[model samples]
Target: MKHTKVKDLLNSTKPVDDVLVKGWVRTFRNNQFIALNDGSIIHNIQCVVDFENTPADTLKRITTGAAVAIKGDLVESKGAGQKYEVQVKNLEILGDSDAEKFPMQPKKHSLEFLRENAHLRVRTNVFGAVMRVRSVLSFAIHQYFQEKGFVYVNTPIITGSDAEGAGEMFQVTSFPLNNAPLNEEGNIDYKQDFFGKETNLTVSGQLEAETFAMALGQVYTFGPTFRAENSNTSRHLAEFWMVEPEVAFNDLDANMDLAEDFIQYVIKYTLDKCEDDLKFLDQRLTDEEKQKPQAERSEMSLLNKLQFVLENNFKRVSYTEAIDILKNSKPNKNKKFNYIIEEWGADLQSEHERYLVEKHFKSPVILFDYPANIKAFYMRLNDDNKTVRAMDILFPGIGEIVGGSQREERLDVLQQKITELGIDEKELWWYLDTRRFGTAVHSGFGLGFERLVLFVTGMTNIRDVIPFPRTPQNAEF
Candidate 1:
């Protein structure tokens, strides 16, 4: 007999005979009732067992975390919470879990505790809902691009150019660290490295995606990106995924529009598709916040927060305007901010971003025309020569969810920027070719996928959204 998914049976309109269900036992109650879950849905299907007829030895094996199959009659649940229940006629234990040793038992767990037990975290309700929503969001991302006829481009994972120009990329080398071959300059000879040149896990796929955008007209890269930054903040993840979409003949405004629309579409799609999971997360967040001080808690629930993004247009403001607003804001005036905004050229921090979104604008915000010195080299230079055609999308809780810019198409200006930054010209010859050969106006943006998931799932920490998080010193399953 085909094994019936718990999700499908829970939605059944009528009774079914001898339905087979296989799942890990969530809990065994009264030696007669079992809560079984297969991760197909957030809720578990109760399986009523025949304790009188069943052997006591077999009954002892139906412990939490144990894998079991039940052949039962699906009937209307007598319990108040669920709609359906299974009257088990046959039971078989496929695998027995040591109840004493299983890390993920039915209980409230700290996020840090679950992080330590990531391999088994999904067995918990919180991780299950988060991961389910994550899967739906990922599908929505690809679906959003594919439906729009955008070419899906797979950029090289090992790349030579630092797209962000942040110098925080993790170096990739096959040579043993201590025994690397050296040249006369007393530096490791990268020419002898695996790629015949120094390479690192890509920080961004924007540069490579731009090359494809020139030919394919529109292209996007959804892949893993790495940053070697050692920041231990909840929002920072050394290894995360990025969604980079590049479009030819697109100016900065068009880039901003594409980003806003793409994000809203995927987010809306996820919200619609993962209703149950999102609801679970919303309740989970509400429950978690009850322990926090009122001032520190989120003003809106997760569902409302997501709906707010979908309902409102992102307020577009320039960097100078944002600086002015932040400078006069209560935090800056009262010296409440950790990093006060004193001038125009300083980069905005998360606190400032949240202030703009949740306090000032009370909506999603987009601040454009950032200082050239602070942005990457690829951004198009403005007439003022001090700012670039760059923009960032800031959300209420998650600051700077998206970063993008109108790419510099002029070879001379780009080379000048590269030279001024002391970047190796020889290394970026291929990227320069796009400008050299028919580089029309082009623009693109990169959305941190994990950050998006964090926002959509109402997860405060970026690590909680991704399955296996790789931090500065911690890389475990």
Candidate 2:
């Protein structure tokens, strides 16, 4: 008989006889009821067995985590929890799970413990829902970009130049470390290496995406990115995915509009498609928060927060204006901030960002026109010659979800900035060609995909939202 997925079975309009179902057993209660899940949805379908007529050996095999196929009659459930259930007439244990050996039993486990057993953690309700939401969010991103006639470009994973200029990058090489060939200056020789030059995993696809955008008009790149920062904080990851969209002939205002619309569309899409998962996560967050102090709890529920963002416009503020607010704010006045706001060129910390979004504005905020020295070299310089046309979208909980800018199009100014920053002119000659030949105002932004998932799912730690988190001192499967 053909097997029916649990999701379809649960949503069936009418009862049917002799339906076949296959899934892993979640729990077996009273030797009669079997809870099964197949990853189609977070909810499990109840399978009731006829214990009186079934053999003891076959019944014992229906343990948690065991795979089974049951031939049964679908009827209205008598239980108050679910709408329908399967009355099993025949049961076969395709795979057995020893009750004593299985790590995930029918009980609550700590998230830390689950992180250790990352391979099997998805079988749980929380991880299952989080992953489903993550998948839907990813699809929504592509759908939004495609609907707007944007071309999707695949950027290279390995590159010879650093995009962010942070110098925290993982080097890609095929040379043996112990006996590496040395050059005349006693440096590692790259002539015999795979790429014949030093290369590393790309930190961002914005640089490559720009080249395509110049030709294609508008393009977006969604792929994995890497960094070698040793911060072991909950929000930091050694490797993660980023979504970058580059558009030709766009300025700072148009770039802000694009980012705001893109984010709201994706959030709305997830809310519409992943209703069940979102509801489960909402309750999970509420229950988890009950254990903490009232001051530590979130101001709004998960659904309410998402709706608020869609309904309200993100507050736009200038970097100089934000500096004045922080300098006069109560936190800075009371000496509560770790880094006090004393001057104009000081970088804003997470505490300051949260104060703006969660306390002062009570909505998402976009801060633009950052200091030129602090921002990337490619951002367009302002008339003041001190600030650049950079913008960062700050969410309520997540500090900075999107970072973007209007790129410099003047060849002379760009080349001067590149020289001042000490970036190799020869290495970036191809990039410079775009400005030299046909210069046009262009803009784009890069979003941390996992951070979006973390906000939507109401997960506090960024690590929990992504599967197989790569952090410092930890790279387990």
Candidate 3:
């Protein structure tokens, strides 16, 4: 018999005579009702069995986390929770899971406990919903860019240069740990390495994406990026995916427009396509918040928060204005902020960003014109020479969901900035070549895919949204 997915079976209008369903058993309750899920959707289909006629050995094997195939008749469910169910006539245990051995039982598990068991955590409702939403959000990103005639570029994962100029990078080498080749000066000889130079996993695809954008007109790269930052916070990940779009002839204004539109479109796509998963996550968040104090609770539900983002325009504020607002704010004046905003050139911390987005603006904020010294070298320098045409899109929960800026197209200015930052000029000759030949005003931004997923799924920790999170001192699967 052909297998029918639980999603299709549940949405079926007419009853089927015979159906074969194969999935992992979520629960076998009362030795009669079996909850089965095949990762097709968030909800599981109930399979009612005739326990009296069934063998005792077969019933014993129908435990949580057990994989099974059941041949049954499809019929409308009379149960309170679901719409349809399978009346099991035959059952085969494809894989048996001992109830005492399986870590995920038919009960709620803490997010931290689930993180430890990352490989099997998706079987649970929360992880399943989050993963599904993450998949849909990825598709939406491709869809939005493709529809706009933007070419999708797959940038190299291993590179010989640091795109972000951040010194923290995971070195990719083939040398033996204890027997590495050394030069006459006792320095590690990278020339003897595989790439004939020092190489590391790419931190961002924006620099490479810009090369394609100049020729292809507009290009976007969605791929894995690695960072060696040792920060073990809820927001930082050693390995994460980045969605970067580089557009030609785009200034700061056009870049902001693209960022705003892209964010809202992808979020709306998830809200429309992953209705069931979003609903489950929404309820999950609401239940979790009940344990916290009234003051710490969220002002809006998950669904309501998503809708609010779509319905309202993000508040656009300049860095100078934001600094002014923060300096005069009660937190800074009362010495409540850990990093007080006392000067104009001071970088805004997460606490300051949250206050602007959550407390002051009460909306998603797009902060632009950041101080030049605080931003990357590639950001366009303003005429005043004090700030850059950089922007960061800050969400209510996530501090900075998207960071991008207009590129410094002028060859001399870019080279000077590179020199000023002490970046190796010889290492980035290829990137500099883009400016040497017909450089036009181009802009791009890097959106941390996990952070976006964290925001959309209402997951608090950055680790929860990503599968097999790699953090400092914790790479266990």
Q: Give residue 372's lDDT in candidate 3 (0 to 100).
A: 93
Whole-model Cα lDDT of every candidate shown, in order? 0.93, 0.94, 0.93
TM-score of each: 0.99, 0.99, 0.98
lDDT per residue as tens, model 2, 261-355: 99999999999999999999999988998998998888888898899789889999999999999999999999999999998999998889989
Per-residue error for 359 in candidate 1, Å, reads: 0.9
Stretches of candidate 3 off by over 4 Å are none
Query: Model 2 lDDT vs. the true structure?
Result: 0.94
Instruction: Give per-residue CA lDDT, model 3, range 382-423, as digits (tens).
Output: 999989999999988668889999999999999999999999
RMSD vs true structure, all candidates: 1.0, 1.0, 1.0
Clashes counted in candidate 1 amount to 0
Consecutive 10-residue window with the lowest summed lDDT within model 1:
157-166
Residue pairs whose backbone atoms clash in candidate 3: none
Lowest lDDT sum, 10 consecutive residues, model 3, at: 159-168
